[model samples]
Target: MKNTILILFITLLSVSCKKEPQYLVKIEGKQLPISAEIASDKTIEDFILPYKEKVEAEMNTVLSYTPKDLVRIDGKLESSLGNLMADLCFERANPVFNSRTGKNIDFAMLNFGGIRAGITKGDIKTINAFNLMPFENSLVVVEMTAEKVTELAKYLIAQNKAHPISKQLNLIVEANEYNLTIHNLPLDDSKTYFVLTSDYLQNGGDNMVFFKDPVKLFKLDYKVRNSIIDYFTEIDTIKVELDGRFTKEN
Candidate 1:
C-alpha cells in the first residue's frame, strides 16, 4: 500500500511537470460564407441607431448647387473641378492669412489627385465636401521666393497634369521653355510670394519639394474640407469654368 501511494504521487508529479504541447495549425480550407440568417444583437442596434440617424441627417443637408458637372481627369491642363477647388481654397484662406500675417496670398495650388470626387450637376451636400476632400489636410501659407516660385512653375510644366491652380497664376508650356505669370505680371526674382497650400504638400507630398524649404510657414489651422463646406454654405450656387489657367503650346 505504501509503495502504491508513493508510485501514484510520483506519477501525478511527473504529469504536472510535463510541458504543454505546442500547436502549429495549418488552416487549409476555402473561405466559408457568412449566412444572412445571423441575427444582430438588438442592444447593439439600439445603441448605434441614434448616431447613425444624426450622421445621415447632417450628411444629407444641402449646402449648394452646381449647374454643371465638375470632374478631375488626367492629361488635361485644367479641369472644372480643379478650378473650383483651387479658387475656393484661395478665396477662403486668403482673408484669414491676410488677417493674421497682413500679407496677401499670391496663389493657391492643390494636387489634382487630392480632389477625390467630382461634383454632379445637382445639389451639393455637406457629404459632397467630405467626399471631395477626404483627408484632414490643413491650409498653410508658404512664403517662397520668386526663384522658388519659378521652380514650382517648371515643376508644373514638366508634370503636365491637371493640377489645381488659382486664377492669380498662369502658365504657358512650350516645347522647351515655359512662360509663367503671377497676377498678370512676370515673376520678379527679387520678390517673395506667399502661397497657400495644404500642409501635406508643404511637407513634400506629391513631389512638391519646392514647398519644403519655405522662408516662413503660417498654419491657418483651417482644414481644407471645412473650407469647402464653408464656401458651399455661403454660396447658393457653385459655378466654375476652365479659362486656360494652364495651357500648352508646341
Candidate 2:
C-alpha cells in the first residue's frame, strides 16, 4: 500500500512539473526582452511563427475580398468625418466581440494612420488591408459622452496637424488653425456614449487620456478591428460610388 501511494505521488509531481504549450510574442530593440502571449508555450520557434501565420491568414481572408472603399457624407466636414471613420476601420477587422475574452467587438474606432492605402478603382486584397494598417493592433470600445466628443474635437483642433485622428476629421491647413463644431453641441453630463476604439488607445498608449475620464469612462468588451471585419463581411456586396459629401472641409 505504501509503495503504491509513493508511486502515485511521484506521478502527480512529474505531471505538475511538465510545461504546457503557449504562443509567445518577443520584442527586440530594447535591452530587456518583451515577451508575452495569447497562447501557452513561450518558445519562439515552437509558437510565435505559426500563430502569426494563422492570424495573417485570417486577416487576408476578408481583406482579399474588399473591392474598394468609399466615403459619402453631406458636407466636407461630415465627409471628412466619414472618411476618418472608414480609414480607422481599415486598420483592422474591428470586430465587436465579448469583452471578458478580448474578443472582436461591435462598433469600433480607428486612427488615421491605419488608413495607409488609398483605394483605387479595382479589387481590394489582404495586402491592401495590410498596407492600410500594418501594426498588430486589436480593437476596443469605450463609454464616452457627447461632452467627451466635444473634448475630442477640441483636442483635434488644438493639436492641429499634430493630432493623430481618423481620416473622418478635416482641418483647414492653410489658416494654421482648425475649428471644431463639437463645442457648439450641448453636452449632458450624465449621458454616456459608447465609443469603440482601437486597443492601443484604451491602454493609455495613444495619449488620448480624455477617453479615460472617470465620469465618461465605461469599458466595453469589443475589438474594433475584428468587428469592422465582421461588418464588412456582413455587407456581402461591395458598392463604391462617389457621394461627394465631404463634411469636414466645408
Summarize candidate 2's per-residue lDDT along 1-250 as a digit string, tens digits.
Answer: 9999999999999999999997768856757555674455557667678888887776566432335444322232333434434444533433222335354322334444444445444454445445555666665556666577667656555543222334333334225444432213334566654555666776665566656753433344334434345445555545533232222242
Report the Cα lDDT for candidate 1. Answer: 0.92
Q: What is the C-alpha lDDT of each candidate?
A: 0.92, 0.48
Q: After superposition, how far is residue 73 of candidate 2 from its true place, in Å?
A: 15
TM-score for every candidate vs. truth?
0.86, 0.47
Candidate 1 per-residue C-alpha lDDT over 62-109 given as tens digits, one digit per residue, 9 for 90 to 100: 999999887987338899889889999999999999898777999999
Counting clashing residue pairs in each candidate, in order, gives 0, 50
Off by over 4 Å in 2: 1-109, 145-147, 160-186, 214-222, 237-250
Worst 10 residues of 2 by lDDT: 241-250
Candidate 1 error regions (>4 Å): 1-35
